[model samples]
Target: MDTPQPKQLSPRRRRALIFASLAVAVIVGTSLYYLHPIGILAPKATAQAASTTLFSKPDTLVSYNFESAQLGWALAVTETRLNQGPFWIFRTVDGAKHWQRQLVGQTSSLFLTLASFQFLDPTHGFVAVGNPISLYRTTDGGMHWLALGLPYADGYAVTFTDPLHGWFLAWPHLWSTSDGGNTWNQLPDPPVDSTPLFLEFDKWNNLVFRSRLEGWLGSNGAGQPHVYSSADGGHSWQRREVPLPSGAVASGTLRTGVQALPGAGVIASVNPSTSPNALFTSFDGGTSWSEVTPLPIGGGTGDLGFQDNLHWWEIYVGALYMSSDGGQTWNHISDELPSAVSSLHILDSQHAWAQMFFAEGSVLAFTADGGLHWTRANAPQPT
Candidate 1:
């Protein structure tokens, strides 16, 4: 029985075998790392609500959305840890008065700079994080989060109309999910110029859908805006050449913003250089476009919020402006606002929220009285 030992190799051959094994390990590890860069372990990551009592506000507020005045969620950086993510979500049931620590990423060494969150209702929502982007979905609010296994390594934004129907953007590639983020299929690319469309990474609102079959996609910071409309839910698209207003000298790369109105309409904002931006509307679901009115070039016209066809809100030069006559005329409303706002969400005629950045820190301002007054939930400095 002792004579059954395995043969040993020469010293040189043993060293060569060892080196070969190490090379294989290196190749496999690198491939896995590329698949999930920056430690974005989404396949098995579990998100749970954090219990640590940090400051009153978050450190760095990245994204936030609310279904109602009372029910809302905010994603921010609270701490500097890997196992318990610095990216934390805070929820407010009684409006923005007091926010509770709702959830935290459990992935080790997870890193991201920008993030976007949208809540379709109080129960269903999605969050997309950038910098080796990943998407997560929660059906029972933020109580539990399941990492969506997106086929692409990078995701710019995500929008969900219902619990099952949603759209994802990985640059020029657009993917649609019908199984509540469980499975996805890539949609055909629009015939429009993909070069400028690919450069719209900062503008997340460019890709929008009103329903399962209706959607609008546009590009900004690209020369002369290129917008497209789809009636069959992005299976096919038609390019819309938006016309500039008369006597307006087009300068700089065109910055465009598009919003899908509920039902059969869409609105677009075209800002040519430093001139006043113009608003356009299409009643036949982006089939035909017409300019409505010109808004004063106070701030940039990138942020446009509409409660309905006629009621719209815009933050211009630290002031709130409203247009009831379908953006035909603008009226200023007295309110305390910042010179710039990162994001604006208008729930109705009265209830609205804005995320503002200050030299002190970022603050989430809420207005219940239609921009007449505001109460800010100040974010503490990042730890």
Candidate 2:
């Protein structure tokens, strides 16, 4: 038995032996199959079955039949060579897939700046008209517009909690409308040395106001921005200095939009600037502030709106960015749009519309799926 022991192969020889064994086994198996057929050969089919599921086209616009829905309405403006004219009101009861243009009286200058449009319900709404100092209301879902003559001088922004209660602000002045925008009475002006600039109303009816009232008002002034709050419906305002990010100076330009969160006294704003624009959040009811984050794509104007306190969306450079983490982070979702977005309006968390301003063209793109996709609604042909 001791003399019959066989020699063991080395590691390298072992590997070679395993490889040779595998090769021999494969060759033998192949030879056996070819030399003697064991199973019948089936004819090959030329065609394969098509996949049953339908896929959405990546570039196709999501359709919404706005003509059947009561909330469906269009916001359009006629832009001239020199200026953009009054905003045209269009309504579609179905969903926004189709729109019927309404005839609002013509204006002298197409320079009619419409800052904002909002509806408390299907039948009642408010529109902020720029330069001429006018706010229009339509109780019949924009079938006809009635001019609410408020003292207007370059009005920048307007918001309404309901048909009877609303707020509008021009620089240095805050006005409240109790009679459905028919008459807007001015609230107390900022201190003689203070100059108030932007205005917003929160869900709790607290008014959030901003300006350089604490410092200087213009370029020569202190160049700092201030935030003020009024709990008693703009009867009196309390001022607080809003802190800016390190190395960032307060931009004197009026902010584009302000949105108020429901439970958290948080307010958000789109800080306008040529450099990287900022989205700011204020937790203490606009008294103190902090920059949420720099927008993903910089350069174009930015606007902010909230579907709720936790969900936020912003539009800049014709793209939509959504943040579910209260602006801590953002996700870019603007592939469907064709042009840069100049303004955005959110009806709720699911439904929204954006106004696209083409650089050299007169066309506008509208989005319904939180800007996931967009469709070209209307455009003026080139002259």
Candidate 3:
């Protein structure tokens, strides 16, 4: 007897069943990007040793962390040749003088190493990478990596308040690791469903951990706009009602762009769906919020970065703005943003670095005189 073939759906039906998902990267370190071979602009700073090559081709870079002038990490994935291609990491030390690459894939695979990476310091870090998606830790500043032996979980976003205490998040579930990710235990949560109430399509993913027990969750895909504060790590939550923008019928929540500042303050950009063209600040840890002055940029704060509570930067469509008195007023730091900066790690009022998107690819950029001058930096690559 001949074997039978599986049934096939019609083209119209197949098309109707298709769906798409956006990959988000929530990095808990400090990092950004730029690649150059003597770029159109000359080198302006001497802190960077030399511009280096991270990958030979274009790739997706996410979960960036630049903890200091000499420490940073990020996940770089290339889908150019998918199964037969390479998935590598981007690491820099020695002040971006030379970058070392660690390959994660020997052959092609559909899996991403992890959704994001959290590095507490130059010597300790954690990431969720593997076929079934497992957690890994690096103690020697990512020079070598090992698995935590934790059970397979879909966790892609993680945050750490210290070297040994952190939180892991997947949708609808939150886990805690007190032993530096060697083990993880599921934490208690509110009676709400798996999805978060607010939403953002990017990696900011609406999550920030202020302490071992206090954290802020921005939005999820399946709910209304509401910011949830978890005082007991993820055990339970209290809703901090936010004021809706003027002319808005109702207030909603957003995923990315929720920034936690010193002294239990939070600055968040209101989603257009929730309100429209406004940012808010909360002094009482989201118990209540007040609309601040509009930012200098006439756009959303998708790629917002902060040097501190009083100093800020907003990156959108190649434009960057700096604010001093909250968002009441902003200074156009860079008339033309080098690229969409993922995060800006300001070493001081002058020295800073950023991981960003440029020409549809990942690259590194740095500054020595605030935002006035920028020089492309290098990323990690193979030895």
Candidate 4:
């Protein structure tokens, strides 16, 4: 018998059959893959680089020395003489890389004097200006600052524990504000004989009230720095004497900046004296204090900020020093920076920012590896 001849389907039917078979195979393959999954994609690597870059070069203003405040955000203040007018406030939200100048009407003189600044949050803060304490409040961050008048004009240190409660130390007394700096009430004059020129709040409700209370007062003012503790807010205070180290004398005056470790009941204060760079720590919540070994460059007027309860750092003569053992010992970390630093701030144990003031003006520097290496940030111009 001859080979059976197979009948071919129509061309259209053959094409349709081929397409339908392909569609069926694709559908089955998709369904099976979805139903029973297998490793189809490559795995991503978990090991990351040792150090990550957080900020690049910063553009800083002309003023080498300015104040910085840290709440949820960081803020710096600068002054410039633009056409013989007062310097406007230039602020940066992105860690000082860029800044925006605030326009808050013209003052009698273009010379704006920002004495002190404190922020309860990134948005809410107070800025003190002039001989008479003219307090300004900003609810919408630092974009705009509105005046909140306090009777005391010459305010030194301003602090806010929360949005509702804040304090400012003028020459003779301490002022408290509970209504987000809307109004102020003076606390009974602090227990010290002379006016309390400087003060700081410890986490344990202890006030490191300084000035004539512990140091010298009047024209020939110069005395040993004394620390006072107030358990019941500012109602009462107990004097705590910080013992000087074995060789140093307790003759030097305490500086304005005071930092307290609230969790560890440790307080750090700058003592500018004839002795070695003096620093003090109080373990008993300001009731008692002990002197910490000094840093290399001696302490400057800038404040000391603690990285943690154990590590403390200070800025002096454009260099940074760190103490790992609760201020007992210190190591110089200045060589890691590019320029001489004016102010130093520690956001946490790992992150820190320093404003370097050099002959070429100022530059903002940030370090992610705990001050090991620093990179510049773009600073804002003062309006």
Candidate 5:
């Protein structure tokens, strides 16, 4: 591979914005700005690595999903400067000690995960790549990919209920993929505002659907953000009212992020434009909500992994915190990870994987013994 040289002002400017904050003002989910390349500056230093550094260079890792400590998958986006380049699909069978890179597709977003990507398992995955947008699928793990049968992507977000059922979101445009991601049939778009904008990180990265019959989508363009509820998948949606925080108004710059657990209630967090934010949990879908606890503004809201009302991990600026007994109690983990924590997928009370984000590179961290210890994982190789 050739050394990455700074590309154009367009890609660099966009990339810088994506790494700065997960701030999206768009109502519909499509308000995203893709950033690729190092631009004229080098990588920023924020988080720290283990005594045993995961990678010698600056390649980064993203812990998307995991089956076990021995088998997992992540995204490996290399730091580049010249033109948009191919990113990697990272897979590990024996934890993070060793890693293999499978080149996927050329990207315009340094933060490609925002460009819409997902893997149902080690065998089936989808990635939207290049401009005018295209979707690619990998069935035999990350070994190879085949172009998906779709119309146009222009950057899309995809989610899978299983290896066979899935949904694709590109804001006003939505599609359903029954046989994994091989092919998609366009569906009726969600009822959103006429104006179309991009979101850096509004609430959830994409639409959160607990089941085919139940899901939640966000709209935040006119003034404040609103959560849309769907009883019959994306076929139709209606506004789900939420209890606002002390300083939040029904409409303004207020935004809420929602996550639904398998056996637990739907939990959502609200960040107001002016006042302190609060976390809320709804046992009956999103129709009615109650406040759980007040939240401390952290390093970043990149990764707010909530296992239940009590068990979850969140970051602030750079500090990491964990809660075991829902939100009634809390513990400060550390503030020197490297960058803001983006994604934290906790397997049990003890083991989990996390990804940190910066401008030029991304990083990975994992803990086998709960919050007692953490190990910096691996980065991609300079190909």
Candidate 6:
């Protein structure tokens, strides 16, 4: 038989067909972005990567670190429940106007698993993920990451002073890396007494390194607050006896957190679950701590953020306080915070970011002009 010409649709029919095809494409693209399948979908952290397209905004923030008022990163999960699965590392270069997904973690366990991250600067960063944790290092500001071996399956925190010098803490054991994070060396067992009675090092305690050779580890929760100084790059540690305020007896479980200050000192806040909290300072790099001021407010537990020894801030029980003279005195800034604040970062006396948690969801708050005023930054919004 001879070849026959095919029939063509009319103008109206053609328009309908085109619209139908476009609708289908839109639906498929949205489904893929929203119902992101675990392990199958991973975002490329490139300069040209589209922001807020490949993944969902964080349901809750796990941890966050800001190198400056404009540059920062947050470790958050899409699920409301923390242990459900799928964690993401988001970087905001324009002061939280937009956040780019730098990393994704596939971790869904029956038990709760936590993720911790640290950025030595705006460029070099490290993240510890999964229940039996996996460590990754990014030298180019999360544009790329290389997996690093961990000495232990479970680790609570990671701190890097420089690209070459870093430390990882897995409760009683600590590990160090001198050549970036390519290899790890198990350091001398942490001082027996430095370990907290109930290990929540990832939450209340912190591991901070001031330089390649000097670092401090704060052990708190369910015991007398303890601070240990590691002078030889975490190879050895010594307990820095943190004395209580004069005639201030400990009543409840005291929690302590130490922040390596800007120039030459360390700042610590010893907050108790009960009343009568205290703040301490160390001009000698945590070797000796003297009570700076008896905290005027007391509560369940709070967080401390420092721009330097001279400028510090604290968020406790949904209220904000600032100290102009290095934690000696405080002025209540605002009580309008929704709830608990985590990832409290102070870039300067004026610029800062904090993730505030409430009953419905979490919001990222930014402050300018020394926290006298605050505004909600453009965090990821659920589609």
The estimated TM-scores of all candidates read 0.74, 0.59, 0.74, 0.63, 0.74, 0.74
Q: For residues 99-185, could you state the per-residue lDDT of candidate 3 as single tens digits? A: 555325421221224334567777877665543454566666665666565443443355678878887666556788888877889
Estimate, for each residue in 170-222, the C-alpha lDDT of model 5 and write its tens digit: 65688877776767778788866421235354434347767666777654443
Worst 10 residues of 1 by lDDT: 21-30
Stretches of candidate 3 exceeding 4 Å from the true structure: 1-51, 54-56, 80-86, 106-114, 190-201, 220-224, 251-257, 274-277, 297-302, 339-343, 381-383
Model 5 CA RMSD to the hidden true structure, in angstroms: 9.1
Each model's lDDT comes to 0.58, 0.45, 0.54, 0.45, 0.56, 0.60
Greater lDDT among 3 and 6 belongs to 6
Residue by residue across 300-331, what tens digits does model 6's lDDT show? 33667778778878877557788888766788
Answer with 2 or 3, whichever has the higher TM-score.
Answer: 3
- Could you give the C-alpha RMSD of every candidate to the true structure, in order shown? 16.3, 26.2, 12.1, 26.0, 9.1, 15.3
> TM-score of the candidate numbered 3?
0.74
Encode model 2's per-residue lDDT on 92-124: one tens digit a residue: 544433445543332222212223455567787
Give the residue spans of candidate 2 off by over 4 A: 1-70, 75-87, 108-113, 127-135, 151-159, 168-174, 182-184, 191-224, 249-277, 295-305, 315-320, 332-334, 360-372, 378-383
Q: Which scores greater on lDDT, model 1 or model 3? A: 1
The per-prediction tally of clashing pairs is: 0, 18, 26, 15, 26, 1
- State how far residue 343 of model 2 sits from its true place (Å): 2.7
Per residue, candidate 1 scores C-alpha lDDT tens digits across 1-383 of 11121234343533322222111110000111112222133444343333322223423334566788878776654323421234556666766555655555422212122323668888887765433345677766666566667767654456777888888766667889889888989998655453233322334234677888887776555555647778888899877767775556666677666777655577776767766667688787555777776556643453567778778887764667888977778887864665543356789889898765433334566788998887765332222
**lDDT for 297 (candidate 5):** 54
* Candidate of highest lDDT: 6
